[model samples]
Target: MSRRIPLPPPPPPAEIQSWPDREARLVDRALAMDELGRRLLGGRRLTLFLVWFVLLELGWSFVGVALTAFDHGQIDPITLMLVMFSTCVGLAILVPAVWMTVRGILRDRVARERLAQWAALDSHPATDARLRAPTLGLCWLLLSFAMCAVGLWISFAVPAGTSREDGGYGFVAYGMGIGLILWITGLVGLTKAVGHYRFAVRLTGRPGPRSASSGHPRPE
Candidate 1:
């Protein structure tokens, strides 16, 4: 009979050496939450700046138009033509810059929310569905905004003489239609991100350190 040699007490249950390293990483991530939130929400001021810029541009455009109307006889034809060209060029540049800024702000907010969701999970790991919800929403937001921007730019570039029957005009129209759909989808995505953030905060029972310093009052 083979002596039932008790398998050497199972080598004292191989100690999980990874727990300390994982815990340390989690701690570091938690600490970074406040800074991340600050960065994420920092773009609010940029949005305000864009609004002011748009108003300023509109005001300037109106003033130029008014002056041109009254000074038609006094102003040289060549000088008036140059002024109009400059205004058009400036407007083209400004529109694209505004779109870029908006897209950037949306992306930043999405990233910040993702980080907050992660930090919240340290104590309360929610369902996988909930975990992915905000990400999907934010992705939609980003993609839709990009599509809308691209479509608008393309439409703007289409020549004035190009008829609807022309391929360029058709392409621009198609792009605009697709962009509209994406814009709607983006709204849905934003709702998902907001809902997920609220849910995650509830799971953790309070805002993390990031939220505390962000100065935005916690959702009631």
Candidate 2:
């Protein structure tokens, strides 16, 4: 006992608590809740976009049918060919444009959600994914337009036979119809793939930075 000072009493458990640790736990919980809310809203937005897409397609189809019926008699071979080409080009552009717009909206929403999550947790993986639907959609649009151009070239270069028996304009019409159908099917598939990717990202909390890139979950 060589003049040892009396040991101080042990500190209370509460006194030993770390404020930073408590705050971090609170922040993590808040972030998880925020992410949940954001996902809920994202789901609603996705549903609305889908409904809008359906309505737009239905309206456009009805109008196209009406116009064709009204002008069927007045459309000559050249005019018919032009109409077919125009319709293809219009669809090629329209589908992508709509997809891009929808993607932009969804992207903004996701960004906002991510920001909120970041604010709470102060942690997020750096991401360069800007809504790329527009870019990819544009690429597809250009490809479809190019295909339509090729069809147009074929239509003009293929000589209209002197005799109606040679199937003059009918052959061109049939070819145009088939090409249009194929083009539309391709676009539809592309859009569906995009939608599937989006859903997967949302469901799995994966970051899809590009159209083809796969997102992986953060390890627990």
Candidate 3:
């Protein structure tokens, strides 16, 4: 059987002075932790899947619009059934997306706590500048905001066609659907990066903690 949780990252150095690119090394080690790895949900692979799904959802709306003949304002029973089925398939993607988002949030919280403990072991502590919100996280947040804007513009401002009589492929609702997926994925990414940074920052400048029994960082 496949393992449920990812393998935890190798231990970070108790003192970072010897490590080259100290901050990057710290981040790499933290991300290797099982919780962070799982929260990514396969990382870039999941991101690619979301992009494909968003495109599929956007196009499916057009399919639905095509199935209905607006000349007489009447719809065929078989066409309506087919359209409904297609729509159901498209919406089903949301189930997994929602699960990932919620699971990621919870996992990030755990990763943050663990990361703090791990960082606290370093004798040469990180500085506040080194612990600021991660750059990748800011990108996630900014991209999400852009997507939200585009989704709104497409839904409300962009004209579907010369006339709204035939619905012009229902771009409004479709854009919003695409936007929702991007928003969820981006939010999760940002949460992980920002949370990790925050946890590390909080421990900066503090004296290293040691267990009574062992001088090393505790195991997960």
**Among all candidates shown, the one with the greatest lDDT:** 3
Q: How does residue 18 of candidate 3 score in lDDT? A: 49
- Report how far off residue 92 is in candidate 2 (Å): 20
lDDT of 1 by residue, 92-186 (tens): 65566456446655755555455544453344233322333454446544654554465455445544444545544334444444344334334
What lDDT tens digits, residue by residue, belong to model 3 across residues 104-187? 456555654554454443334333234443554455556655655665555455344324564444544454455555554555
Candidate 3 TM-score to native: 0.53
Candidate 2 C-alpha lDDT tens digits along 32-148? 434433332344434444454444454344335434433345667776676676566556655764675466455544544443333223223222122223444344445545545
User: Cα RMSD (Å) between model 2 and the true structure?
Assistant: 18.9
Off by over 4 Å in 3: 1-3, 7-72, 120-145, 155-163, 166-171, 204-220
Ranking by TM-score: 3, 1, 2
**TM-score (all chains, Cα) for each model:** 0.37, 0.31, 0.53
Clashing pairs in 2: none
TM-score, candidate number 1: 0.37
Model 2 score (lDDT): 0.42
